[model samples]
Target: MTKIPAISLRRLSKSFGDLDVLGVMDLDVGRGEFVSILGPSGCGKSTLLSILSGIEEATTGEITIHGAPLNQSGQPFAWMPQNDALLPWRTVVDNVGLGYQVAGRLSKRAARDQARLLLPAFGLEEFSRALPYQLSGGMRQRVALARTIAQGRDMLLLDEPFGALDAITRTELQLWLEQIWGVDRPTVILITHDVREAVLLSDRIYVFSDRPAQIVAEFEVPLDRPRTIEMLAGAQATQLELDLLRALHVGSGDTP
Candidate 1:
């Protein structure tokens, strides 16, 4: 028998009054798979994430998780948005544990203890007591990710988690993220506009068209896991990057 998909979307669409944000779309993300949705900026990519996270209701569609209908009664995913969104007043450990506390799943003390254990893995052990204001942008994102991981959700919804950082920092975090994802293998759905980033991190990529988005093309990355920066420079990776770029250009109605 075939294993059920981690996530399945059929005829998914979203609209706001007179504005349509997403057209009918279908997608499937396999268990423990890293899938990226690549498209131009302002192409309703984030809207899709919002719908999946239950922050926004879909205009029409069906969404299933593990072959069952999506139920929003409890948190189904660990969502990390574009900005780190760390609370400035909270220390790193407390920030990481906030979700558990808010959900009443753990006492504050227990939550912090759990978050402390995860800190070393993210290279954030030394900064456990530091406030968000004291951390660098990259460090803040790490804390944000640690917080996401602390939730222990099977699916991770990342809405351009590294989009705000500098190029160097972003690349560093991508490699770090790949290593972390390798160890735990949580199913990931990443929304991004960067072609090279998509090719480097995704097991498969779905390219979307401009506003009122629809998937225009899909590519399977076939590269080995624990992906490194060096691999991105290899001929196969380079070709995949070129192909994704071409698709993005065509999807957005621009010449490549």
Candidate 2:
């Protein structure tokens, strides 16, 4: 028997009044797979994530998780938006545990204890008691990521999680994320505009057309697991980057 996909969308579309954000689209994410959605700005990449996370309702279509209908009550995904969005007043640990506290799934103390255990993995152990204001941008993103991971959800919807950082920091976090994903293997759908970022991290990539977005191309990255920075500089990876960049231009209707 075939394995059920972790998430599936058929004819999924979204609109706001007179504006259409996403056209009819069909997509699937396999269990523990890392998929990236590449598109131009305002091309409905974030809108797709909003719909999947239940923050926005779809205009039309079917959505399924593990072959069953979506269950909004279950809160099946952990989402990390472009900005770190950490609460400045809260300590790193508190912010990390905020999800559990808000969901009433654990007592404040229990939540902090659980979050504390995850801080070391994200390199935030020493800063557990530090406020968000005290940390650098990269560190703040790590805390936000730790919070997302603390939820223990099976799916991660990352909407440009590393987009705001400087190039060096972003690359560091990318490698860090690869290591984490290798260990935990949660199903992931990342939204990014960076061709190299997509090429570096995704198991598969789907390029979307400009506004009122629809997938225009898809490519599978056959690179080996435990992907490293060195691998990204190889001939195969360079070619893949160029291919994805070409697709992005095509999707945007630019001469490539």
Candidate 3:
């Protein structure tokens, strides 16, 4: 028998009054799969993430995870938005443990303890007591990631988690994220504008058209993981990147 998808969106659409953002979208993210939704900025990509996370409701259609209605179920999905959104006054450990405290119903100390165990993996062990302002942008993102994982969620919804970092830092975090996901594959739906980032991290990629957005094409990343930036320089990965780029361009009515 076929395994149920980790996430399923059917004929989903969203609008703000007269302005439609997503128009009749459908998507499936399989169990333990890493999928990326790549599109140009302001194409309702982040809006889609918000809708799936229940931060925003779809105007029409349904969202399900594991065959259960997403909003109706006590869905255990973690959402990490573009900004790290860390509390400035909180120490790293406290910030990283916040989600665990709320979702896992652990005491503050217990939450900190649990989060501490994950700090080293996310490269924040040394800064556990440091404030968010004391850390770099990338470090803050790591803490946010650790916090998301602390919730013990099986699905991760990342909205350009590394989008604001410097190029080198973003690349490093992408590799780190892959290593974590490789070991314990949680279903991931990453929204990103970077084609190369999508190619490097995703098992499959869905390219979306401009506003009133919908998927225009999908590509399977042919490279095997433990994928590396070096692998992205190879012919197959390059071609995939070019193909995605061309698809985005064409979807936006630009000549490739």
Q: What is the C-alpha RMSD of each candidate to the true structure, in Å?
A: 1.3, 1.3, 1.1
Residue 71 lDDT in candidate 3? 65
Model 2 ranges off by over 4 Å: none
Estimate, for each residue in 1-256, the C-alpha lDDT of model 2 and write its tens digit: 3888889999999999999999999998999999999999989999999988889999999999998888643778999888888998999999999866765489999999888888889999999999998999999999998888887788999999988899999999999999999997999999999888898899999999998998999999979999999998899999989888888898898884
Clashing pairs in 3: none
- Of the candidates shown, which would achieve the greatest TM-score relative to the real structure? 3
Cα lDDT tens digits, model 1, 178-244, are 9999998999999999888898899999999998999999999979987989998899999999888
Model 3 lDDT, residue 157, Cα: 91
Error of 1 at 29 (Å): 0.4
Q: What's the C-alpha lDDT at position 22 in model 2?
A: 99
Clashes of each: 0, 0, 0
lDDT to native, each model: 0.91, 0.91, 0.91
Cα lDDT of candidate 2 equals 0.91
Candidate 3 lDDT score at position 167: 97
Model 1 regions lying over 4 Å from their true place: none
lDDT score, candidate 3: 0.91
